[model samples]
Target: MPSSKKKSSAKKSATKPLLISAGAVLAAITLGIVSWQATAPAGTGSSGAPAVAGPRTDPAAELKALARRESGDKLAVGRADAPVVLIEYSDFKCGYCGKFARDTEPELVKKYVADGTLRIEWRNFPIFGTESEAAARAAWAAGQQDRFDAFHAAAYAAGSKEKGFAEHRLVELAREAGVPDLERFTADMAGGPAAAALKKDQEEGYRIGVTSTPSFLLNGRPIAGAQPLDTFTAAIARAKAEAAQR
Candidate 1:
């Protein structure tokens, strides 16, 4: 969804939709409607021509509650109390996700995260394969040592995914990220906590009907794919204004 040439990987979940409440059902329906527009090939509309922006929709309250604003969350950046929270459901093996990490995210961090205006939270929704799951676990393990950000940057660096995320490769990444305790890193990566954390993220993504990689929720407004920087900036501005009203 980043470009006409690039498309997101579809998640293969066998489970049915987990809409237990009216709010959850509405959230799912809202995402289902907007997701098509959000993932429409860049520069093209349903009629196969350049697309124009559509009227914005109200944020879904149920989705907004998905933001885990824990002050000590290691996989997040910026103040926990930031007015706008961008929750990203992404796979480590997703090329578009890497593009966002390399190109767009740093700018957002510089412009918004630095000022306590936006908080970006990471959700490891690994749908690619075993390697993706391994990488997610490894990332959670890195967070244990307060090195999640460094590890994330390293893992998403240019051409990093070309090398598969095998056990040895994960160890190499841990070293590159400067995780001080190699023995502990390996233990944590293979431990139960890492698996549980990965499951929690994956389940949340599935429940929200996130069918593709790099899906995002900006203050409860669904934004699919790796959209341009301006799209995110405008959404952040709107969310911030709405937060002020509340």
Candidate 2:
């Protein structure tokens, strides 16, 4: 009887340690679960957290979205059904573009576009970084107030005649060109139609491999560089010939 009692006491002592170890493991698990629940993001249906989404990996989709958002009531001047379309990819900060604005654009506008022989569309390709983009946006804002051509002429003239165009200088030009409300113009540039339109132009230019300013596209055929007047004349002639053939 004494031996049996001693054995039973030993068994009880062993069982106590096992029970303590199991309880400790269970307590640790409970604390871990509580901590996870406290720190997880809200709206997670489960007790634990959901994984976060990665960054957008499609560049083409992003550009398409930008183009869609930026093309706000974009206009087409000249005959609606004109056979030859002259798409001019111009940069506000580009010297060559300034030259064209001075010499080529007026001739083209007066001779071809105004005469209804060609459709002229201006796309702003602001490739000279932030300042170019800003200038283009400001011009777009000026357009909102029906002063685009005037603002464009002044800004390009400022770059050509006086000095390289600056942001402050463009603002001055806007004011001088009789933009009714300078403050509203500036604010529109900050966040309105102008910004969106410029972005659209930038995207279209990128997609079409326009890396430089004052490039022209006859229909969809690109004319690289700031080509001469003769080149433009030839292109116009070719476009007219093609239209006749079609």
Candidate 3:
């Protein structure tokens, strides 16, 4: 006959391993859920960031106010009279900003800018540091010679930021972008006009609640990321429809 206490001991041992395995699985599942929630957009998460702003009451008026719409502005593209405007506040050193510039912006230019449906206004909101400020100034300097868009493309080319934007690198980029006068580019980058231009762009961004790089205003509606191409296409379509009714 078996001893009752010994049988009890065997039963407990059999269940102990099962209990440990179940606990581990439960812990792993809980951790996965936490990670998923953490990766959601900051404004939409429990991360304590400010919530995304709701739609504007007077989107068209606010949009018109921010559109600049200057034909001589080298940092802007498309027709000044385009029905939809996309104002981008970005940093030269931000990786995501580069992603949008390289991956998304050209597509927008091709589809909408070429057709006179959209205008893109670039705002120099340099949040990084001295290099960022310098790059912004340099881009503006390039614009003095009518090469701002080219310099912008070179600055945001893949692997460009890893090389850094020292004064010399900026000059090299200007050369690549075909600025007509290297002497003028250097002088303008260090001049007061560059500083003033940067200040104006930065102030505009800050006033409109832009606290991050690559933020955008599409006809006065805020889009806070380098979202998918469809996001932009949809925004442009909606803005165009609304403009037609105005």
Best by lDDT: 1
Per-residue lDDT over 81-187 for candidate 1, one digit per residue giving the tens place of the 0 to 100 score: 99999998888898989988998899999999999999999999999999999999999999999999999999999999999899999999999999999899999
Q: Quote the lDDT for 32 in model 1.
A: 57
Better of 1 and 3 by TM-score: 1
lDDT (Cα, 0-100) at 94 in candidate 3 = 88
- Judging by lDDT, tell me the better candidate of 2 and 3: 3
TM-score of 1: 0.78
Weakest ten-residue segment in model 3 by summed lDDT: 17-26
TM-score of 2: 0.65
Candidate 3 wrong stretches, greater than 4 Å:
1-60
TM-score of 3: 0.76
Per-model TM-score, in order, reads 0.78, 0.65, 0.76
What are the lDDT figures for the candidates, one per model?
A: 0.84, 0.65, 0.82
Model 1 whole-model lDDT (C-alpha atoms): 0.84
lDDT of 2 by residue, 78-148 (tens): 67556667777787777778877887777877888787787767788888777788778887777777777
